[model samples]
Target: MIDEATARERVVSTADRLFYAHGVQAVGMDTVRAESGVSLKRIYALFPSKDDLVLAVLRHRTNQWNTGIAGAVADAVTPRDKVLAIFDFLAAWFREDSFRGCAFINVFGELGGGSNRVAEAVRAQKASFQCRVAELVRAAGGPGYLAPQLVLLAEGAQTTAAISQDPDTAAHARAAAETLIRCALGDSENAPTV
Candidate 1:
């Protein structure tokens, strides 16, 4: 017999994969059950409802997003490099075979109008990400005002890359971010770009 935690993990991970590739509304519980190999009874017992499962998926994805960004930043040697590393992460993520844009944005576009919980979760995740960017901006000696602009660039890049199927969108966004960072932080013109 599978333990509750193991069953829950299977369901969430499977749901995340399906929902991201298809969409939140397109895939149903039965599909989740069949794909995950977790019985419907176990899925409902663990998630209680589709909304519950979706929320769990969002939580799982959020953990992944945070870990990726943190690792990217951690590998950088300087504050400027740390800030730029976010786009490096995005560029790499955009090139993944399974790339389907930000799950939070995808779900919000599909269900944000009808589901308050889903909307709130997406908003909270985005806010957390923006806050992280803001902190990085401060550390990089950029003016506080530059964070939102940088966040918007990153957000826009995700959407553009997903829709255009162009991994270079992140590089374009990275170039814009470098310019913004230089302008806000007063970096010399001779500073290397890239």
Candidate 2:
């Protein structure tokens, strides 16, 4: 018999991919069963409803995505570098063939109006991303206002990158972020742009 945890993992992973690729409303638990090979009864036992499965997928994906960003920024030697590295990470992600911008952004557009639960989950990812940026700003000795500005740049880059199918947009966003950071830090004119 498949272990409960393994089964749960497969279901969530499969659902995350489907929901991300095709939008949440397009995918159903039957499809999850078809792709994941978990029995329908087990899927129901694991997730009582499609909404429950959607929540599970979003929560799982948020953790997985955040972990990737944390790992990508881990090698930066300074807080400022860490802030810049976020765009670097996004650049890499945007380059992938499977890239379709932020999953939360996609989900919000799809179901944010009809479902409070979905809206909350989608909003939570944005909130968390902005919160992390604020923390990074504090660490970098930048003013509090800069974090939201940086988040806007990043979010805009993501939207443009997805819609325009251009990976270089990530670099563009990073450059803008650098300019904002330098200005906020009151860098001398001689400060070299990275």
Candidates' C-alpha lDDT: 0.93, 0.89
lDDT score for candidate 1 against the true structure: 0.93
Supply the TM-score for candidate 2: 0.95
Per candidate, the number of residue pairs that clash is: 0, 0
lDDT tens digits, residue span 13-131, model 1? 99999999999899999999999999999999999989888999999999999999999999988888899999999999999999999999999999899989999999999999999
Off by over 4 Å in 1: 189-194
Residue-level lDDT of model 2, residues 1-194, one tens digit each, is: 79999999999999988988998889877899999999999999999988788889889978977997798779787788888888988998998999988888888898889889989998888899999989998998889999999999999999999999999999999989989999899775533276
Off by over 4 Å in 2: 188-194
As a whole number from 0 to 100, the lDDT of residue 114 in candidate 2 is: 88
Question: Which lDDT value does model 1 have at 102?
Answer: 90
What local lDDT score does residue 81 receive in model 2, on the 0 to 100 scale? 86
What is the clash count of model 2? 0
